[model samples]
Target: MDKDQQNRITYTVYCINAFAERYRLTAKQAFAYLDRFGGMAFLEDCYEAEHQLSIIDAVNDLTQVCRNQGGKL
Candidate 1:
């Protein structure tokens, strides 16, 4: 699901697990992608991966962006 579709933290959690399952990505791998690249990069990578961008990816990506922009996550 996309960020707008993630209605609750539990849903976010579910999306994370679903994303991991669908892509064979470890939680760490998924998180690292976001941490190193941020939202645009994450979305781009997802598109490159196969057109599946989930909310968990955005959470991590946005976190990375915040950190990069001095928000400290």
Candidate 2:
């Protein structure tokens, strides 16, 4: 993959791990929750802005986005 693609993937994985930790979920669970609740799409669609924020802030955004989509945590 190109550098930009690789960077996006790396950032995505990092966010997934961070999101998992923040919500006390395993990575697989985190991915499933995100996939179900639209957090994954939020991360992809907003990657430019989201990547500029701290990982904590990014995960907070993920949580809110997921919660808004009916996620419990």
Candidate 3:
């Protein structure tokens, strides 16, 4: 993969793991929730800015994004 694509994947996985831990969910569960609730799209569209932030900050942003999209947890 290209460096930019690879970096995006790495950052995305990092965010998923951090999010999972923060929410006490498995990585798979986290992925599903994020994917279903629009968090994945938000992350992709905002990757350049999001990855510059700390993982906690990214997760917080994702949490809000998901909540706005109707995610319960």
Candidate 4:
């Protein structure tokens, strides 16, 4: 992959790990959550908004939406 793509991949992985650790979830589960919500686009948004948005905040938002939609974590 190109440098930019590689960077994004690395960033996403970091975010996934952060999410898993913070939520006591497995990496797979964290990835599933992101996929269920909005996939890489969601991660990208989080990365872009890092200055204004915390990862936990983003995950919380996703969790709330999932719960509202009758989806279990």
Candidate 1's TM-score reads: 0.34
Models 1 onward score TM values of 0.34, 0.96, 0.97, 0.62
Against the reference, the lDDT scores of all candidates come to: 0.50, 0.94, 0.95, 0.69
Ranking by lDDT: 3, 2, 4, 1
Candidate 1 residues lying further than 4 Å off, grouped into runs, are 1-7, 34-73
On TM-score, the candidate that comes out on top is 3
Cα deviation of 40, candidate 1, in Å: 11
RMSD of each: 9.4, 0.6, 0.6, 3.1
Off by over 4 Å in 3: none
Q: Which scores better on lDDT, 2 or 3? A: 3
Error of 2 at 46 (Å): 0.3
RMSD of 3: 0.6
Ranking by TM-score: 3, 2, 4, 1
Q: Count the backbone clashes (under 3 Å) in each candidate.
A: 0, 0, 0, 0
Model 3 per-residue lDDT tens digits across residues 1-73: 8999999999999999999999999999999999999999999999989999988899999999999999998
Candidate 3: give the clashing pairs: none
* Candidate 4 weakest ten by summed lDDT: 42-51
